[model samples]
Each structure stands twice: as C-alpha cells, then as structure tokens.
Target: MILIKFLFITAILYLGPVVGQQECVKKFMDLSLVKYRAQNIGTESMTGQFMASYTLRVLWEYQFNCSCVNITSLILGINIRRVTDSRRLFPSVQVFTPKGSQYNLVTGSERIIYYTTSNVSTNGMIEYPLDPPIKVTNGDVLAISQPFKKASVVRVYYINGINFSSSMEYHIGSKNIDTSNFLVSNELILVYPVTSGYCVNSTNSITAEFVKKKALEIQRSQPFYYLSQYIYPQIVFSCNGSVTKWIFGAYSMGSLSRPELQIWRQLGPNNYNKIGSSLINATKMIGSNLYEFIPEVPLQFQEGDMFGVYSNNMVNGDSLILYEQRESGPMNLRIGPRLVSPLSTISFLKLYQFTNDYPLVTVEISQSTDLEESSTTEYSGSPYPSQLISKPSQSLSVSAKWLIGGIIGAITIISLASILVLACIIVFIKKRVNLHNSTDYSIIDTRKDDTKKDDTKQDDTLIMNDMTSVTPMQDNSAYGSTHDAAVNENPAYDSYSDGTYLYMSNNLYATVDEVKQDQDDDQYI
Candidate 1:
C-alpha cells in the first residue's frame, strides 16, 4: 500500500502540468482579455495628402482582470479606403509599460515587436494576427500603439469619451516622436491569451458583485469636438426594472470639478422631470478615452419610463462627452444642435439589480386516519426545480464540410476514370479477335489451292506413262503391224483421224488413229 501511494503521487506530479496546459488551451479558445465592437458610424483619415515619410500613431492602454496564462496574438480593427493598386501601407504595432501614475501619460520600456504591410484594398474591420505571442500576468499595464506609413486613407473604429478613468490613453505623432492625447479616439484593439487554467475563487468579489450584467446598450454618437463653458449634453434612455447601478462613459479634464449625473423620467413626449441625482465619479477607465460613472445610491426606475443622465459641468475645455446624431431616444428636449444638446448620442451604459424576487406559492394538506386521529401538513415552494438546458451541439464547420466534399469529388473522379479504362480494354480485345479471324481465312484458302494443284499433276503423270508404253511396243514388228491394223479398223479410230498427232525426236507422225484403235481393242480384250 505504501508503494502504491508513492507511485500514485508520482503520477500526479507528472500529469499536473499536462492537465494545466490542456485547460489553458480551452481557456484561450473561449476567453478574451479585451474586445471592442467595431462600428462604421464615422471614419478619420489623414487630413493632408499622402506622403511616404508621413507617419500616424494612436496609443491605447488596457488593464487585465486575471493573470494571463499566455498571450498568443493581438487583433486591431482597421479600415483602409481609396487605396490604389500601386500603393502600399506598412502598419506596425508597439507595446509599452507604464512608467508613472496609472492615470497619467507616462510610458517606460517600449518594443517595436510586430509589423505588417498590406496592399489589398479593404474597407472595414481587418484582423492582423501576431506571429510571436506576448506573455503577461495579472494587473499588467499594456500600452499599444499603431503607426501607419503610406498615402492611403486608414481609419480605426473608436468611441468618444469611451475611456475616462485613464485606463486608456491615446497619442498621435510622427514616427519616433512622442505622442499626445490631442485628437485621439478609443480604438478597437484586443489582446489574446485570456484567463485560462484558473478557477474562480469567489463570485461575490467587489467588482463582480457590483456589476452583474455586461453593458447591454451602446448608442453611437458623433464626437463632441467643441467644449462649452456652461452647456452640457443630456442623455435619455428608456429602461425598466429597479436600477441598482448606472454606468456612463465620458471624457473629462482631470482638473475639472466632479460633474453631477442627473436622472430624469419622461412624463409625456418632450416632457421630462428630474427623479434622482448622483455625483459622477470615475469608477474605472477601460482605455485612455472611456470613463465609467457609478452612482453611490442605487436608483430605482419603473417600466416604460424614459430616463436620462445629464452632466451638470459648466466649463468649456478639452473634456467633452461623445454622442452620435442617430434617432434612438423616445423623447427629445432640445430642438437643434444648441450649446446643450438634448441627448448625447453614442454612449455605453449598463444597468444592474442586486436582488430579484420571485412569487411564492403555499399549499396545505389534511389527512384523517380510521382510528379518529387527524394530521395537517403544509408544503411550500417546489420539491424539484427545473434547470437551465445546456446549449445544443454545434453544426459542422465550413472547413469540415469542404473536406468531406473534396473526398467525395475525388472518389467520383476515380470511378469515372476506371470506367473509361475498362471500356478501352474491351474495345481493344474485339479488334484483336477480328484481325485473327481474317488471318485464319487466308491460310485456309492457300491450303485448298495447293491440294488442287497436286491432284492435277497426278493426272498428267498417268498420261505420260501411256505414251511411253506405245513407244516401247514399237520395237516388236509383228505386234506393231497387228496393233496398227486393229487400231485403223476400229470405228472409234475415225474419231481421232481429224487432228491426232505424235511428235518424237523432231519428227511428227499421225498416230492418234492407231492409239484410239489400240485403246478400243484393249477394252474388248
């Protein structure tokens, strides 16, 4: 048992890192440290003409919530417009560490680590994957910057006053020059290698408990470039539920006094009454541009009520709230683009409630026994409550479908090729058989002609033997005279007398009559 325990401990020691790595991979696939939704509501380009030496830079900072297991890549949304075919642009990414205060513009170590160049025309969000991943840990201050070198118009999606707590800062300048936060917008940039391989220790942490829901609504508004000393924009939202918390994004100068966040409820169309008021305080700044405002006391709101957050600051400075001109609010107070607009257009806000109560049901039951004893019981609520269903299985991805189709297509092509080869083989076999049959017929005809010639030669040989017999018998005089007389007296001999002739040793003689007479006499004998 001691040996087994030792072996088991050793196994765990060896497998712990492996299991951690697997969990890290899963976390990387599902989590993101920073993400900003891109919008095409507006675009900013280089104000002047294109110059090869000219460079534009934008800086942003992000704060991580958890210790990063690994940082594999960085993604930024870029828009390239009116780019010519012959023109090209090289965009480089730089990361830095903050040097001084978290809310100030101080940077320390800098690295020009990643760079990419593109010539293809692109209009909207384009992703650039970093080759070498950056490693980071918890609470690491990350400052990211992008420098573009080209004549083409390039735009990055941004929100105005999106980061107010100084968590994010933007600076624009020439290449290798110090940047300033003059006209910088909150850029949509993201870093990878999110929280993984870590378990949540507590869900009731201060930040998690306060913010239960993510920002639900984002209204896109134009950047408020001009600042007025006594005027501020009012933002209205139609909301429901007893709001326990309110968050707003804005941009302000650090020297300005705290602004008042006024909550208003709509009585009728274009009529709003102030309901609740809270002094705006910066909770957290996501990036250099976005600022968060959380009320001290949770404001309660009814259903279908038009609510609004109005900034009461009356100072004209570089600090201004960003809003879009889109038609989104249910009611409007100001008619035109006055000093104080009725509604600030594009803003990000979240509403949360801490306690939500459900209705209760009670039941009572009474039972009586045959022996006259009775009992009463009470039941409340549910014995078995329904749980939320798990998510359905995901369908096959595009790459998987393409792979299956390619395999099927290859099989079909092979089948067609095989059938074509088989047909060619069959046709060749038939042609060979036809050629062989024609050759056999020619051989048979030659053999028949040779046989006929042999029979004719045999007949000619028999005739020659008869002629020789006549010549040999000519030496016998008595026999020859009697044979001659016999041949001439025969009536058959007359048949040969007209043309029968014999030639021997250059001398010609008419012996056909004798020959015919001899033949007739021989037959009779």
Candidate 2:
C-alpha cells in the first residue's frame, strides 16, 4: 500500500499541472567541425545574383518518462523550441506517440506516433497525441524518435554588409546562468604572436628587395590551403617571472590523423613563491624543476600548426612536420640555476612538398639569443608521403664513435681501481707475515752435559756418576727423595719416572692441556 501511494505521489511530481503546462527542456547539443575550405556563403558565380548558402548540420536527442496507471486512452503533444528564444520552431498540429525503437515500431500499432517539421509558419511548434494510453506505471519508459526534418540545420547566409573575420557567439538556451562567479583553476591567455619577416641591411637596397622577391616567389610556388584544426599562435608574455603553468598544442597529418595535444607543467615550488630563480642562457633545460610540473589551460585550439603524417609501417610517404625552438629571446627565461623553458615551443605551419626524388630538405633556425644557428638535414628516400625517416647512417656512425670512446674510458678507470685495491691487499699480507716471523720464539735444551765440563770437574763428575749408578739399584723408599730432588733441579721438567721417559717440549703439549681443560669445564657445566 505504501509503494502504491509513493508511485502516485511521484506521478504527481512529474506530471503535475505546472509541469504539464511547460515543455521539457532538451539536454544534448552538438556542432559539426569543418576543414579548411573557403566559406561558400559569399563566393560569387558568373550569374552575379547570389550563391546558395551552406547549412551547419546538427544532431540532438531527448528523453522522457511515461506514467499512467490503468489508463485506456489519452493524447500527448511535443514541441521544439530554440533555447535562446522561447518561441517554438516546429508545426503544432502534427503529433506523435512515443516510439520504443526503430525495429519495434510498425504501422497500425495503438502506441504508434507521428510528427511534423518546422512550422515556423505556425510560430515553430510541433505537437502529437497518443490514441489510447497503454497501461503504464511510474517506471514505464517512453521514447520519441525521428530523423532531422526541414529547417533542422543552422542556415548560413551571405550578407554583403557583414564581416567574415568577426567572432560570433551562440547559446544553447536563453536561460540566464551565473558563470562569472564560477572559479577557473587553470587557464591560458595568448599575449603576443610571432610573425614572418626577412632580415634587412641598410647598405644594400637591391639585396633586400631581392630577398623579399624571393620570399614572395616561394609563397607563390606553394599555394596556401586552409586547414580545419584551430591553431593558437605563439604567445610571448612578460610575466612577473612567477607564472607556473602553460599548454602546448600540436597536430599530426597524413594518412593517419593522430592529433596530440599536451598540457606541460612547469616545475617549481608547490605553493606560489614571491621570488623565482635567477635567469640563465636560454638553452633547453631538461630534467629540471623549472621545466615540467604545473597546471595548464583547458581548451581546444586551431590555427595553422601542421605536421607530417607520421607513418612507421608504411615507409613510402612524406610525413607532416613542425618545428620547435630550444632557445628563447634575448633575456634567458631562467632563475638562478633553474631553467624556465626546456622543451621548445611548438610551431605549427603550412608548407608544400616535392616529389620523392627531391633533394634533402633542410630546416635551420637563426640564432637570436643564447642558442647558435643550427640546421637539420632531412632526406626523403621514397614516394610515400606520410612517413619520416631518420638521418643518414654516416651521421649515426660518427656519433657512435664518441659513445664508444666514453664507454671505454669508464671501463679503464674501473680496471685501474681494481688493480690498486689488489696491490694494497698484497702489501698488507706481506707485512702480516713479517710481523709473525719477528715474534716467533723457540727453546733449546741439552739432555746431557759436555765431556770437557766433566773433565774439568772430575771430583764432582765422579760423585754424580756414583749416585746415578746407585739409583738404578735402589728400592722405592731409597730412591724417592733422590729422584724427586734430581727432577726438581731441572725446573723445566714437568714429569719424571725412572722406568719410562717421554719428551714433550713442543706446542702440542699446550694444546692437549687446553683441550683437557675444556672437557673438564664441559663436564662441570
């Protein structure tokens, strides 16, 4: 019961008396983009009266909901009105039943509908009604469909008094909107533009005239073709040196029209800074903080920025090409060590082409500030018009030589470092060996006295011999004090026994003592 009540209330909200009285506003709008063809509106024919003007093709779609519960019959009408003016633009008598789809629609269907074209005669209003309202609820969808009818397109007329170069503004609806208060975070404003001119010398009037004539001749040789894309001319602004954002727009032409537009951010402090870095010579500053890291303008532009049709797969065509400068005007666009302009500004242009066998096309930029004048030699090997080939192999070989030389130098330095380290290690080992040899100690002990000493001490030697001989025949009790006293006389002797003898004056005896002590400690632990 609650759901039914809610549906009833929603139906009233959508189809109330107030809403029924007013027409539904459309949501979609589109404008066609045309290429660089001269406007046909003003071109005069041999007849001299006037030319048939062109129309701007437009497309739009609108949606509506149907909600009628248990209804048997009803009539509905639709009206089309220009948003700028409240007046309707189609006939009012013609009506239509909301169509479901192109395939689902047929003749004699009860829910079928029809419509009429611009009834500007009737103040531009179109209306249609449903014969019987098919049982529909709050969720039922109703769609009205039809092709573009008469006067649906915007008419372009030739007016002798009107100017072709002036700007025009059109609104989708005349409803007043407060866009002035809307905040814009990023925006681009073109300040100044660069123009084409030739250098003049005061001393030679004929030479200057000849140069101008040659320029004009070149222009004549390549007839100008109006391009479709909008181009933003190169702008040079005298900023307070605090501007942190900009945008670069360019286009690709040829068989594949892959147009690319980018908004590059100038790197700097995240928050705005009052003072910027000092300026330097205006060479391209790559991988720096002042080059790419800021907000950019949001809009589409067109002018004459043209480039080659970049073709990689199909290698037989000439590509559309554009130029960018790596330098700036007289004063370097930098602050301290930070550079302002790194990648060059894009320059879109219009130029002609030659046949496949034509000579290498050379592009040169004359020096104006810190950058020296330089030229690029481009070759066209074949007749394919959309591809850009690299420079000759001979140039690449020259560059490769320098790269190889640097690599070799780096390797040599690393090798020398390794050798120095190895020499130091060898010296350290030799010093360690010398230290061990100088500290080494050994003991020499005599087991027997010399015969000469015995001869000199004949009385004492006889007594010693007599005692040794008696000890060999003595019992345990008799030899106990004597043998103990004899062993004590040799303070270096650790153990002594009469029947067995063993010598242990080497380091192995000390090692065995240490192992035995460790075993005793392990058992205690």
Candidate 3:
C-alpha cells in the first residue's frame, strides 16, 4: 500500500509540470508569438537567451516548446572587424580559350586583387535555386568569392568549381595551378559596416539635462561654416566643445518636461538598431506612462485609440483635463501641437468637450503609506467603468444638413415625376375621348348620306324608263300632265341629270361613306 501511494504521488508530480508546459506551448502557438518574440529577442547583439526544443514524434505527432531562458534590460552593440591583412593580391590571372592559332594575352598580365568581409560568419556562400537538378557533393563549388577590401590599386576575381586533388597546393602561388578546370569571372563590389551605431549605457533613472546637452552637442557638430558664416549668424558659442562638456557633466541642468520623460520611457532600456528607433521609443514611453491615467478597454476606434481625463478639483481658465489615444494607449491631449498638462484642469475640460466628451476614464490610484506590503483598493463602479456624457461631434451637424438636403431633393424629384405622369395620363384620356366622338359623327353622317344616295339613284332610273314609255304617247296630253304632276309632288329634286349638281352632291356623300368605312375597318381589324 505504501509503495503504491508513493508511486501515485510521484506520477502526479511528474505529469503536472508536463501538462502545464504543454498548455503553455499550445497558448504560444495559438498566439503566433514564436516568430514575433524571436525577432525581438536580441535587437543588436544576441543578449537575451532563447531556446526552442521540439519533442520528437512519440505515439503519433511532434510537439515543441520555445521559451526565453534569460532576461536583461540592456542591449549592447559589437563592432565588425575589417580585413587588414596585406599579403592578399587582386585580379586573378585571365587566360584566353586554348587554340592552335597564336593569340596575344593583351593588357591583363598584371592586375591588383581586392577582398571584402561579410557580416555572415560563414564563407558568405549562398546556394542558388537550381531549375534542373544537378547531382553534386555537399562540398561542391558553391559560389566564387570576391575581394574582402578595395583600395585604389586593389581589384577582385572569381573562380568556379573546387580543386579536388591538392586543394591547398591549388591556392595562390602553385606550380600546377589548373586554371583550365575553374571558370573565372570578376566584378567590383561595395562594402559597408554591418553596425554603424552602438548603445553606450542604460538606466531606469535619467536626468533631463543630459538629454539637452547631447542634443546641443549634435547641433554643434553640424557644418560650422553653414552655422557661423552664412545663416544663424546670431549663434555665438566660442567655447562650444568645452561648454558642451561642462553642461553634460553637470547632469543637473535641463528641465524635466513631460515630453523628455516620455522619450526616455519609450527607449525602454533596450537595443535599437533599426531606423525611427528614437521616435518609436518616445511614443512607447509616453504611451505606457499615459496608460496609468487612462482606462483600459476594447477601444472601438479606427483613427487611433481613445483615452479620457478626470479631475475632482479644477481651476478656471486653465488647461487641465487633457487626453488622447495617440497610439494604442492614452496620451496627453495636444492643443495646436502643444501637450496639455494634467495639473491644468480647465484646459482638460475644454479639450474633453472638444473631443465630444469621450467617456473612457481611469481613477487616480491612491498611494499607500506602508511600503512593505501591497494593498488593493476598491472603487464604486461596474467591472467595466465609464463616465458617460452627451456631446456629439461638431461635424455631425453638417452631416445632418446634408442628409436633410438629400431628403428634400428626393422629394422634389418624386413630385416632378408624379406631375409629369399625371399630365401624360390626362393627354392620353383626352385623345381617346376625341377619337370616340369623331367615330360617332362619321357613323351618323354615313347612315344619312347612304339613304339619300340610294333614293336618288332609284329616282333617276325610274324617270328614264318613264320618259321612254311616254315618247310613244307624245300626242297623249293626259300622260304628260300626269308625269308633270308626279315631278311637282317632289319639288326637292330640281334637276335629275344636272352634272354639276349631281357631282357636288355625290362627292359630299362619298366623303361621309369613306369616313364610316374607316371606322368599320378599325373595329374589324
């Protein structure tokens, strides 16, 4: 029983750390901090110790663990050593292609050879990506080396392929220098230092005077002729170098302004080799310090983040409450490019109002008199705190005006469209009514004219037949009188065969008939 208990305890202790480490690895992988953290490990020189270990495939998979083994606040820069040896020669011997015919080796017998050093510790050999794979040994002809340094007299050379037998003897001065086996080429190359600047020192506490002195010294070192003789004539620092030394040595002279401290904090006692290092440092330092007064929340802002300020006691007409989220964290609000101080409450309120009463604010942490123990303070607010106030952007009024104008324009367009549509509808209705009225008139006129024309034609035919019958009875006076009486009965027919009268009457009748026919055709079709 005792042995089993001991084994169980041992297993628990052993597995606990393994499980925790696995969890850490999982978190790091999910975060993608491997590459990001590795890049920041050693900015200038490899000071921070980092080790990554991959657990070999056990049952089915592989796992890894990456961690920082050591942490230091200081990063130092190391200078690169240049090639100083003098025995090396320049420009390898150039040999023309072998031919039976005689050819002169013109103007290339004697030449200067130069060499250059690379920051990479290896022989500076980078393998090329091959298209068609070529079978070669590991120690194959990688690339031809160039001169390590260059002078007015020095030059460079290149050779392809490795010397297999007698590799050492094949160097510079050898009897059997098989130049035929190696392909030779040469070109001029430029060399620059890997590192141009170095960090001198780092401390948590730095005075403001030291920074100003350094700045002044840098100004003095600039072109003196340009400073004194030409422009900036009022500048008179006769003992410029000596004065700089005394001012810098004092270390107790410059002002401890907010901007200067912010600059130092951003530098963060770390190595900075890349460009914009100073600006980055300044921003970071100021931002981190500002975070103390600014509340931490998921600031839903794109034009940088947002921070707020608060003061229980404030003076009138003083710029006090000032806040801005310049970067990721809260920053001191700027009034026309000048930083507002926290002590000035009135300015803070004005700036706050200017920024639309941004409500994300933090409380002033109370100081503890006892230094030995830590204390936690509670405030009367929700988990996620905020000081809400109503103040919309001034631009919102302009936006509202634009919105109203758009609405008005849309309404006007719709009204005009409706009026046009109504007019078109009325015109269409009027045209339809006119067409119906014209058709009615044509039908009435055609019916009346048709009856009159039929009656006239019958009358004319009857008259002709009567006249022929009466010619046989020319002497009969009774028959002639009877015909005359019948004609007189219908006195409306003044002429039965008058061509002018008949033509006029027939044309009027034909016009009426044609109109009626057109109406009928329209209905049929």
Candidate 4:
C-alpha cells in the first residue's frame, strides 16, 4: 500500500509541468511532453484512485475530432507507472482507421507494435520511435490493447482534466470496438501532442519585417529600376499552406487616405474574388513610406494561392505603391501582370503573363492550427473542474466570407433589375399624361375661338339697340314711300359747336347742315 501511494505521487509530478508549457505549437517540441494519457484500472481501493490496472482484455481507445492532412505524430512515449517489475507479457500498442464518430467500427492497421514489461523503469517515460512516420487520415484512431494476467498486472494513469485530451472507452481484446453496452469514464487521455509543424532547420516561415529588410538590401546592393508603367501586379505562391505575411516594397508614394488599388484572393485555378477591405487598407503606416498588411485574424488556405494588385499607370512616381521589379529571382517565384476586368467575366484573372522583371514582393506560409486540440464530447463542457481545459481558440475562425461575397453580388444584380423595372413604369406613365394634356389643349383652343365670335355678336346687338332708341322727326316729303315709314322716332338732336345737328334715323346718322341744304333746294318737295 505504501508503494502504491509513491507511484501515485510520481504520476502527478510527471504531468504538473504541462500547465506551464507554451500554449501554442512552437518551433521545437519535447518528445516526453507530447503523448496521450490512459486511465488507471486497478481494483485495489487506494491504488485504483490514481493508477488503474488492466483486468484481462481491457482495450483503451481514444479519438480525435479532426482530419489530419499534412499532420503526423512520429514518436510514441508512455509513462507506464507500475507493474510486476519482471514479466514476459506486455501491452499491445496499435493503430486503427476511423469511420463515423471517431469511435466508429475500427479497421486495424497492418501490424501491432508490442511493448514488453522486461525492463520496468518507473524513473521517467518510455520512448519508441517508428522508422516510418504514421499516416494520418480524417478522424484517426490510436489504441492500446492490454493483454496481461492477474499477478502480471500493470497500471496507467487516469487523468481527470488536461489539454489535448480525447474521449476514451473500454473495449475487448480485439482492435474492433462494439458500441452496444459500451462504457465511458470520468477521465480523459491527457496528452501533450507535439508535431513536426515547425522544425529547427526550417526556412519556410518568415516575418513581414524580415521580408521588407531583404528586399531593401537587394535594391541597395544592385542598381534596380521600377516597372515604368501603370500596372496590376500578381504573385503566384508555390508553397502549400496558410500565407501569414505579405510585404510590399516601400517608396516615396505620397500618403494615401484610402486603398488606391484592389487586392484579390484566388482559391482555385479559375476562382478569383475581391478580398475584405481590411486586407487592402494600407493607410496604417508603421514608419516612413513603408506599407504592410497584417490581419487581426488570419485565414487558412490549402492553395497555391495567387494575389493581385491594381494601380494607375498614369499616376506620378509619388502616386502609386511601388515594388522592386527584379530581372532575375528565385525559380520557385512566378509572378506577372493581371489586367483588370469585370469580376463576372471568366477572363478576370487574365493570367496575361509577361516575361521580364518581376515584382519584389515577399510571401510566407505556415501549418494550420487545426492540429491543436479537438472537441471532446462526453468528457468536455461538463461542469466538473473547469480550470483544466485549455481552450485558446475556442471561439473563432472558419469564416466563409467567400461564399458570402457571391451572395452579395447576386443581391446587387437583383436590386439593379428592380430599379430598371421601376424606371420603365415611370416613363410609361409620363408619356400617357403628356398625351392627355395635348388633347385637352386642342379642345380649349376651339372653345376660345367660339367665345370670341359670341363677344362680336353681343357688340353688334348693343349698337342696334342704341340706334333704335333714337327718336327721328317724321318726314313730310311726298316722295317718302315705305322707306320713310321704317324710320325710328328721334329722341333728341346732338348739336355741335358749328351748329350742325346730328340726325340719326333708320340706323343712318346725318348732320343738320346736310338735312337743311336738302330742304332749301326743295329736295323734299
């Protein structure tokens, strides 16, 4: 019982440092700190609390919730706590391909690697490095099938809480797992998963400041000239991973308040679309004429990604963002000019390649963080001990803005079509109103002519009434016939200053002198 207590304390010391290790995958990983944990299955009450012993064919299986592409785990290091200290029998280390739910039916690997209890050294973790690295697929499964007798009992640790842990289940001796009547545990496989994500001798990853320094050094060393034309530049990345840095050459281009040119993202061979405004805005100058774009949240790309920049060729030397035009460069770097065209056209990324000086731009790539820690189902999110789970990127990324961009374009087209229909309706209504007003005006003009004729008739009637009201003196001339009877009675004579009387009879007006002269000559007689 005293020996059982010592092993339990030793297990805690081995795993305590895990809390203080770097949260992210670093350039180098320790082999001892990077493998998963198993539960202690001993029946002894005191011993079973910290360490578990295999009761016959008990198989410990754990599953990852992600698909592994360029990721692989080469070393298998385990801390076998306690055993009989001398025995021929040991546990079987095995691998299995995953089907549905990671806990799915397992199709075992080609060969099973065995670990013997011949040298039971509890000083530290035991290491086994495979000659060929393990091939990983989507939802890969790693298992340990324990095959031992009662006296030859060996114990493994059942860690209650830790990072990079997978959900564990108890299975029979075979590699295959049966879902019916299966049991789960309060514990998880505690692991410090280290990978070859970044190597010590790797030259693949770099920073934006480094790229900027290198390009400036090249410019000063050799006599370099700019591409003397307004152009859109493109750099086709040959490496396959998420691009973390994009450095543009610095020049005396006057300060721009907004993005002068467009930046585009290429997902596939022919797929091209405008990236978010966050990427193109280089208004934030770190120092002098230098311009660099570093996103607050970086996106992952499994691509030979190509990027393009559009600028005005007619602008002055101080107008556009400048990059060194290199006559000769790394053979891996393939860059040229991409003419601007409408996004709807298939000819948008017009790989209209040019053969000479290339843009002195820098690009770098890194492995995805998807290999960090997968989601745990049965053991995770439970209200047990919350402080143990290290969920750093627990709440972000995997955004599909590219799909969203296509949806927005479709909405824009629909909006334009609606506006066009509304315009046509307005034009049609305007024409109908104009035609109605023209017809109404023609009828109004005819009514005005009739009104003028009626006015003339009224004036004529008034003149006749005035003449009929004048009383005329009765004519006594014998020559007067029926014409004299038609004369109107004269009211009064209007005399003038010359003593001439105005005689108006039968609608005829005459002066008094003319009437008197006629009487004097006996015209009446």
Winning model by TM-score = 4
Candidate number with greatest lDDT: 4
Tell me the spans in candidate 3 whose CA falls farther than 4 Å from its real position. 1-341, 344-396, 442-525
Question: By lDDT, highest first, what's the ranking?
Answer: 4, 1, 2, 3
Candidate 3 per-residue C-alpha lDDT over 73-122 given as tens digits, one digit per residue, 9 for 90 to 100: 11111111112222132222211222233212223222222222211111
* Model 4 accuracy (lDDT, Cα): 0.31
- What lDDT tens digits, residue by residue, belong to model 4 across residues 292-378? 566555534432233433432323543444443222221111111222222321232333222123333333345442433333211
Ranking by TM-score: 4, 1, 3, 2
Locate the minimum summed-lDDT window of 10 residues in model 1: 354-363
TM-score of each candidate structure, all chains considered together: 0.22, 0.15, 0.18, 0.23
Q: Model 2, which residues run further than 4 Å from truth?
A: 1-224, 227-410, 436-525
lDDT (Cα, tens digit) per residue for candidate 1, span 414-433? 66668778978997787677
| TM-score for candidate 2 | 0.15
After the best TM-score superposition of candidate 2, give how far the Cα of residue 455 lies from its true spot, in angstroms: 32
The alpha-carbon lDDT assigned to residue 158 of candidate 2 equals 19
Q: Native-vs-model 3 lDDT?
A: 0.20
lDDT scores of the candidates, listed in order: 0.30, 0.21, 0.20, 0.31
